[model samples]
Target: MNVKSINILMIDDDAINLKLTEVMLKKHANVNEIIKASNGLDALGVLDKRGDIDLILLDIVMPVMNGLEFLSNVYSKNSNFNIPIVVLTTDETVKKEAMSRGANGFIAKPIAEQALIQEISKLIDLG
Candidate 1:
């Protein structure tokens, strides 16, 4: 499948981290759109409009509506999205929690571009 067809939603509160992630992924990874949301509530809004997203780059902790909370809402309401989710974080504890919440895969923050792509590749099979 063409990478350009997949849409990516990145949910995080930090501007610098979001910029870095966008910069890193833009280098080679092609996608239809790369949407950024500062919090889970904002992300849910995006997800509502675009339910065909192929992947989500989720951060476990945030000020308004954390990733886990987002996942729960997604699972409960967004029946259309059986989308692959890659939890991005620096915390190991949050990783465990995110996994339990239904993340397809995960990679640590200080986001490594290749590692992110690798995780996405694994989940893209479903996409």
Candidate 2:
């Protein structure tokens, strides 16, 4: 996959986590843009407004709406929601459920730069 640009939507309630992940992506990946959302509902709104988002990095637990709910909403509302989503979480238990729900990948929290890059690479070209 030879993508000309890559836009990522990172959904996490924790501001620190979001910032850390964004910094890591900027340093290690060939990302062009990074959009942020505090929760699933916010993410939905972002998705509605932006068609350029190529991928989503999601957190499982949140206040307004969690990652699993976000997956359900996206898949249920739009059958053609083809954007690949990678769930980022500290909990290992949700792996099976998240994958079943429609997540393309899963990365344990305190995200390792190399692992995050590899997971994103599998879903979409970082370039």
Q: What number of clashing residue pairs does each candidate have, in the order they appear?
A: 0, 0
Q: Show model 2 residue runs off by greater than 4 Å.
A: 1-3
Across 30-125, the per-residue lDDT of candidate 2 in tens digits comes to 688999999999999999999999899999999989999999999998999999999999999999999999999999999999999899888885
Worst 10 residues of 2 by lDDT: 23-32
Clash pairs (backbone) in predicted model 1: none
**What's the lDDT for residue 52 in model 2?**
95
TM-score of 2: 0.94
lDDT of 1: 0.83
Error of 1 at 69 (Å): 1.0
How high is the CA lDDT of each candidate model? Answer: 0.83, 0.93
